[model samples]
Target chain A: MFFDEFKSWQKELTHYSFEQVSQGDVERALGHERLDFMDFLALLSPAAKLYLEPMAQKAHRLTLQNFGKSILLFTPLYLANFCSNQCVYCSYNIKNKILRRKLSLAEVEVEGKAIAEKGLQHLLLLTGESRQASSPEYIADCTRILRPYFASLGIEVYPLETQEYRELYAAGIDTLTIYQEVYDEDIYASVHLAGPKRIHRYRLEAPERACEAGFSGVTIGALLGLGEWRKEAFFTGLHASYLQKTYPDVEIVVSAPRMRPHAGSYKPQYPITDAELVQILLAYRLFMPRGGITLSTRESAPMRDALLPLGITKLSAGSLTSVGGYAESTETGSAQFEVSDERSVEEVVAMLRSKGYQPVFCDWVNLRDRRGA
Target chain B: MQQVNCELLNDPFEIGGQKLRSRLFTGTGKFSSHELVPQIIEASGTQVVTMALRRLDWRNPQENILNYIPKGITLLPNTSGARTAEEAIRIARLAKAAGCGNWIKIEVIQDQRYLLPDNPETLIAAEQLVKEGFVVLPYMSPDLGTARRLESVGAAAVMPLGAPIGSNRGLQTRELIRILIEEISLPIIVDAGIGRPSEAAEALEMGAAAVLVNTAIATADQPLEMAHAFRLAVEAGRSAYLAGLGARRDQAEASSPLTGFLREE
Candidate 1:
């Protein structure tokens, strides 16, 4: 598992500060030569700021080369907001006194149809970390209900056992998105006060377990602002690289979800600047040129548009964080976080088209469905 | 007009149903500018030219390398920098989807220091890609077993490296490549590390179906002249191979009259 490798990498990365990276390291990283893990550290160093123009140029060229002009569009269908964990930064914490909603099979169909009407073929089903409210069987049931409308299905919920992941895979869910939230052990414990989510090792191993269960792709993320932003970014990039090398057949994606204003009053310990976030994204691109990048609507419209050419391959459009927000936006308090980009699916598609970016709704096809045995 | 080589045209070089008139395949990397690609193609008269699938830009007219490549040339889109079989397959699919064609050169390199292709992953990718209807040409280390496996998996050609990529060392693995050509029934394409025209000729003279050259022609002082020189060399080598040469001998065999007038025998 990557958790074992992550511990040694954490030790390996302890002494280096973002300021310690030199100009020569940055120059070597920017050259035509292939980059390694150490070169990746240099690109993530603070000194890389001096060469941002060249870095951005390389990132853009690399993105255009690998992904072409296609920007895969997906929308999240928040099925439930009930949680048993008291994560400080989240709005769906169990301690929070709010009306929690869980979508029934009938309601999930409505949400699926609503997203399909927007012409989205990719759907990411999300829920708060509460097994009682949103079990693996329940998520699989929802996947089967939505499978007819969408070409691809993903889950961003509580981590499950390998067997449970296999169940979801059998139900046509090909992608898994789980956020480690924070990599720092002390900070991780401090934020995740209670529930299964507090088990740090389990969350860190979720992506690998899902890959073992035969999930086609897995998106792992470290929620920015909970821990030191630079260190979090470094670990996130390293984790993605680890998963890529370990499971060569499974696709890996990384996201930098910066802290956003939620229903809670918890303040971020360290806020990453826009420039710093740009550096992180550029570093991920240069390190893993062919890896997928998911830029969510947590960022504002202008920022999202600006970062598209920088190496983002996947974009969440017309996303509804509140439970059953697509069919009916009744549970206003149930939203996990506030989305800065409130554009409709058509508007987002049009924005991509205006920039000569092709919005790909579904890049993967299910061979089983194509040729039924 | 130049004299037509009717004898050379008698036996057409074909791969995956595409008949190529020239045995010299060229690459688009290591060039100082994108505009030079078409000029080299014109000078080399190569029927097949390769480009890294990543370097192809469709939206940006200025960055689009395909705009510079003239028509009537088969585009061999290689999966460069792909560290695994899956990554190479992804690039190959994307290349075909982007209208590059059915031709793909599978290069799965995990060895960072030497940039050597992983033969195991190359074979796996070549098998999967061939099943998906691609004319897969896998570039790999020269091993007789791996070459046979590639041929069995329906690869259009087996591309064995002469040396490390971009090393400018010529025919470092000549014996291994020769074994592959002699053993496998498929077309053997010698790819990478052929820095001189003579090296390209050497491979062809040894019965290689084709030679893919990049750094030699692209990085030369006069790229067009170098490409022209390679073109002539490849033709001469092919003609020489086809015409056949005299056998090797341990002792001095006389080509002239061994009479008492010429020698005291």
Candidate 2:
């Protein structure tokens, strides 16, 4: 349903001359209490780069006002690196000659315990898109095993049917995060050459389906380096706003992750510098003041720390992108992508404290299982 | 300035088995600094303060919000993000486990525009939380029927909004709140939208059991002074209510005899 809406906006967005987004547009967007999609585009334009300082200040104040001086900390547990997709940017692309592995139920528990021992209660389970290895049934089983150890469980796997999402929710999953990778359908098709991920419309509608299945929260994002950063950011903002309006009960989180080096030797066609990334994050904060904005370990330590006060409400700490990496200490299998910030969970926590932020671990409780208790 | 020499107001009240001296309840949101909370509570003489439930910090587990709160003040953990009864119940259980005791402010609001509390969902949450042994104080829109339902569901108190949350519009639903104050047997604590001290005093004068003030004080230039002002206002209003207001008349009544003035003679 939203695909049509997105297409119409996309067509209109392409026609707007980027030079027309003047300083006046930026100033007007900043003055309004509520920002619209056009305001977002204006903020993302090059003309608005001069107003970065003021934008950052507003973002900082708004974040502090809404979320307080707290950062929600979660670690992604790479459940498996197996895949059937042929995405150009990822290391786990099926055509690449790499080691493939998926953790057994026992291994999942071991990794879960390892993270729990660090006093973390929120976890995001990641896996490559492969039905044979990382199927919905298998993912739900992993959720069942780790539900007791973690307070909140999120999944970032392949897209699924509405009924499948419902099954995962019944198995103790609290959130579903599905990034479109890139919003431009043409760019998306070129990158994801072969796989179910090539179906752009299906992936675009995953979050809505997840909401239909009754997820408490859903996170969406776009990889910044693949397409034009401005266009990608605009579409990402549009998508998040739509989901936010459609499902008021669900928490819609948006992330702007930069492309990282992986097995596939593909460089970004439209690279986003650190400054541009900062502008994008600030635009997201100004547009959706109450929505959750996340920053992953894909960014460098200094970069993540600098952007923390700007608008980031969630961060992944001590993340490993490989399956069974946490339990064994050594690299057990292929990683989806190389992690930039290799700090331990403790180090990240200490960094948060040094920055005067309180790292939050367990923000949600599972009531579905304890309905009568 | 002329001093009124008003009598000291000392009407103690009880909610959820806790005896409270101050009828003013404060919140731990929108403050420029958390350190200001203790000072404000002390200045206002408020015995109850509310905080929302969020994720615990893993790095510094020892550094807790409860540390900032004084020993005797009652900590009310609000279910601010919950949109359904199940979610509220979950947050309440987790809050109790986090050592906040059993007090919970059920705020089930799904509307993002005005942030109005959802009455039906709030009523459901209050019923469930009460059954789960929580001291449930549900925030709701000022509707007589919903207030009666919350009371029937065993809510410890019914907190009806004076206006939409954080609006600072002050008693836009005054007539409905008056009806609730008149009919509901439970304590009618006016929860949100009271921006000024005079508004808090007005709610008290209208027979509200207590008033919860957050944005008015927290967003002020001097929170401590504002807290002190609210304390005095609540006391004055409660005293006036207890002392009983004079009946209204259709026409002006003279304090001195109209026929015995020296100028007239």
Assess every candidate by TM-score: 0.62, 0.61
Restricted to chain B, the TM-score per model reads 0.90, 0.89
Q: What's the lDDT for all of these models?
A: 0.87, 0.87
TM-score of 1: 0.62
lDDT score for residue A193 of model 1: 91
> Which pairs of residues collide in model 1?
none
Predicted candidate 2 versus true structure: per-residue lDDT over B154-235, tens digit per residue: 9889999998888889999999898788667788999999999999999998889999999999999899999999999998
Cα DockQ of the candidate 2 complex: 0.01
For every prediction, compared with the true complex, DockQ reads 0.01, 0.01
Q: What is the interface RMSD of each candidate, in Å?
A: 31.7, 29.6
Candidate 2 lDDT tens digits, A1-373: 6788799998797689567898877877877666667678889999988877777778888899999999999999988889889999999999999988888888898899998888888899989899888899899889888988888899999999999999999998889999999999889999999988999999999999999999999999999899989989888998988887667689999999999998878999999877788889999999999999999999889778888888899999989888877876434778888899999999999999997999998788877772211
Clash counts for all predictions: 0, 0
